[model samples]
Target: MVSAPLPASALPQDSKDRLRLWIRLLRASRTIEAELRERLKQQFDTTLPRFDVLAALYRSPEGMLMSDLSRYLLVSNGNVTGIIDRLVSEGLVLRARRNGDRRTSIVRLTRAGSEQFRAMAAAHEGWIDELLGGVSGNDTQRLTAMLKSFRSNWEGRE
Candidate 1:
């Protein structure tokens, strides 16, 4: 059994305000992410992780090593391997052994993959714009800058 947590009114003013800000940020993030995931599934028949993988590969036309892809995506190699396997099977990506290193593989988007990703990306941008339309451009810029600053200040702080 567990007791209920204290209400927000019990906290000090500053603490309460910070808590509220955190909650709002989290809620907004989750809402947007859920919307994006649903849109991706419905419109593109894809998942966010898959879109992310394709986006990363699209940025690096020359290709990326499997290890590098995992690192860049901040996911484990096994997770990446599964997604890569699916993409390869779908003819959307190619995986080839690196020269002089049979143990390593490099992955890149195929021409078909690149074209498909471009289309998806365009629709994604439009969806995001529509979703965030309530915020003015100035507010968006200010909020973005504040978030960047917050991340910069807190990152690697443990």
Candidate 2:
């Protein structure tokens, strides 16, 4: 029941163009995400959430608090809990009480998890490169800068 998106080319150089740009950006993001999700599942038998958790842990080798991990992934603690539980059961992640503080937990990737994530990360990088291959490096750099500025503009809003 969704209406077809208007063609960006048909939009004038005005507010309509802005709307079209936003729609195009969203569509591109979702398309890439869908493909990435499928590739992660079919190739590694894993989901994007699990891969994201591992990637976060892999970056912070010293480990992170469970709440911090959830925030880093932009997901609720409840959502992260189930993913962590499964990773722990699979021996891909380890959790420990922090310095006799039962209220706090530290989570990190296991050695196996690091190795596995590294492999997946490499492929992921290549996949992104392939998908974005159409864009020239200069254009990509400009687009990235524009997006970063756009994010900062909004994030700074009260």
Candidate 3:
């Protein structure tokens, strides 16, 4: 036999409220992410991870090591490698081994890749604005600041 979980009433009021907030935040994030994923697929035939990779590379015009890219994205090297492989084949990115370090490679966006990402990024911004139209600019700023503080509070605990 298995034990039953505690009832919501058993939780302290503050705990319950925090739990509710977490759920609301998670649901909003998932809903927005799903919508963006669908829009990206329909509009650009791309995935969010691919867009993320491109965005990172675009920010670093020179290039980044594969390990650095993976760390920056908070993903594993293998995941970044697969995406880099695809991007390389598409001619959207170039990967060259670091000098004197054949095992490590630096990745950067090609001219065409930069152009394509710029278009996608502009559209992405519009989509986000449309989706989050209900939030006022002031509210967006407040919420962003609060979230940033929250993240800072919990940073590196994991």
Candidate 4:
């Protein structure tokens, strides 16, 4: 399907505003995520995926089933498996067979892993606060609320 050459701002005014907002949101999110990824690597010699796995385990105290972990992380089972294997080998996580289910395993952070994640969490919080320091608390709250509303609207569209 051939298409005509479009003008720079092909969208109408309101649409252009919404499109600009979306682009700004994407850019801001990417910038912050990139900085956090770099900081995680530099400060803990860890990747975001590893940190995220630990974070999930840390939250689940008793632990989560392997399948559940993958669902919660919104990643494929293979992705979670590799991270879990490494964490298990590093003594940062423990895995055990669930009763009557040899194929399924439960996983959780070990004490060391918990401590390490806590340290990283603290630093991560500070880094975010520093990055967004210029924004007022009220503005932050308003943006968060708006995003939440937007998400709910789309998510509930189903």
lDDT string for model 1 (14-43, tens) is 998898899998999999999999999999
lDDT (Cα atoms) of all candidates against the true structure: 0.97, 0.95, 0.98, 0.95
Worst 10 residues of 1 by lDDT: 3-12
Question: Model 3: what TM-score?
Answer: 0.94
Backbone clash tally for model 3? Answer: 0
Q: Which one wins on lDDT?
A: 3
The TM-scores of all predictions, comma-separated, are: 0.89, 0.89, 0.94, 0.91
C-alpha lDDT (0 to 100) for residue 18 of candidate 3 = 97
Q: Could you tell me the lDDT of residue 29 within candidate 1?
A: 91
Model 4 local distance difference test score: 0.95
Cα RMSD of predicted structure 1: 3.0
Off by over 4 Å in 3: 1-6
Candidate 4 Cα outliers beyond 4 Å, as residue runs: 1-10, 156-158
| Total backbone collisions, model 4 | 0
Candidate 4 TM-score to native: 0.91
Clash totals in order: 0, 0, 0, 0
lDDT per residue for candidate 4 within 1-158, as digits (tens), equals 99986675776788778879889989999999999999999999999999999999999999999999999998999999999999999999999999978999999999999999999999999999999999999999998999899898898364
Q: Say which candidate scores most in TM-score.
A: 3
> Candidate 1 clashing pairs?
none
